[model samples]
Target: MQIRKKIYWSLCVLLLAACRQSPPPSRPNPVLQLREMGQLATTEYELSKVVRARDEATWYKIGERRMLVSCRARIKAGIDLSQIRDIDIQAQGDKISIKLPAPQILTFSIPPENIRVVYSDVGLFRTPFSQAETNAIMQQAEKQIRRQADSLNMLQKAQEGAAVFVRNFFEQAGYKEVTITYRYQENAS
Candidate 1:
């Protein structure tokens, strides 16, 4: 009886341990949407000069010059600007690393002159409203236009900057043909 009781208790303990639930599996990182365009190719050149002297008595000296040639290639791509959460760049002798900048929420006001308001009745039916209403409408329109302009400007700047960066990277790396692939990825919220 004693042995049977011990065995029963052991079995109960083992069953309880086996029945205990385990923690849930972890989730994988979200996938990002990336777009890559065509490639732009260019050549880069770098020159270095070194001077050397021969035997002291001979007084002979020689100058050595080296030309490092490289090419810069760019791949264009589109990305959701809103999803971009961060931008970073890492450059080595012959390699470059780029990342999107952190997402920023910006707000601005518009001016009255830029706003255009059209009314069904223009001549006399047009409500002779107070200056404040007119100003507000104009300001809103101006703001929208300005925002669009700003977005375009930013895109242009980014493209220009990317080109320059690729050129410089190739020149510094002493590579004759350097290819850069621009990739855009959207971050998950």
Candidate 2:
């Protein structure tokens, strides 16, 4: 009976050990292991503008039609760290550097619930602006925001934010000084 009890307890212990989950494998780069650090390190520049979008379908005075909708759009530009590469990061004794990706439009949203149709004008025999029309106008507004990105200095702001984030991270890692830089990918749209 004693021998049987000992065997049963040993089997239970082995079964429990087999059922335990193993730890996830670690990657080569410590920064990559930080999961979403790149995202956390992004700088978002917000721009709000009131856009006047007009569309005309006039040809030879044959049933001319024009539509207009004025809307306010809030655009956000930032970098996404989920696209980070190992080569973009480098570290040495008491010094570290990271090359962040270029900044781009992160979010372009016109809240339907809060879309304030300040003004609208439709041509004769034309229907009023619908939700779909509003959406299309919002797309144009997004383009307008993109056209103004350079003027707003979004790229510089993004770079500053990336540098600050990386600097802090390295400092926490026991580094005396850190330098952060950015490398825009070719055709980074």
Candidate 1: stretches off by over 4 Å:
1-90, 100-127, 139-189
Residue 65 local lDDT, model 2: 34
TM-score against native, each model = 0.27, 0.54
Candidate 1 local lDDT, 1-189, one digit each (tens): 999999999999999889967899999998768855333322211212121212123233333222211212222222333432344445666555555432222323232232333332222322343457444444444444444444444444444455565557656867544444344333432
In terms of TM-score, how similar is model 2 to the real structure? Answer: 0.54
Task: Write model 2 residue lDDT over 61-119, tens digit each, in one string.
Answer: 43333444454455565677777789877878887767777766566555555456676
lDDT, candidate 1, residue 113?
35
lDDT, each prediction = 0.41, 0.66
Candidate that scores best on lDDT: 2
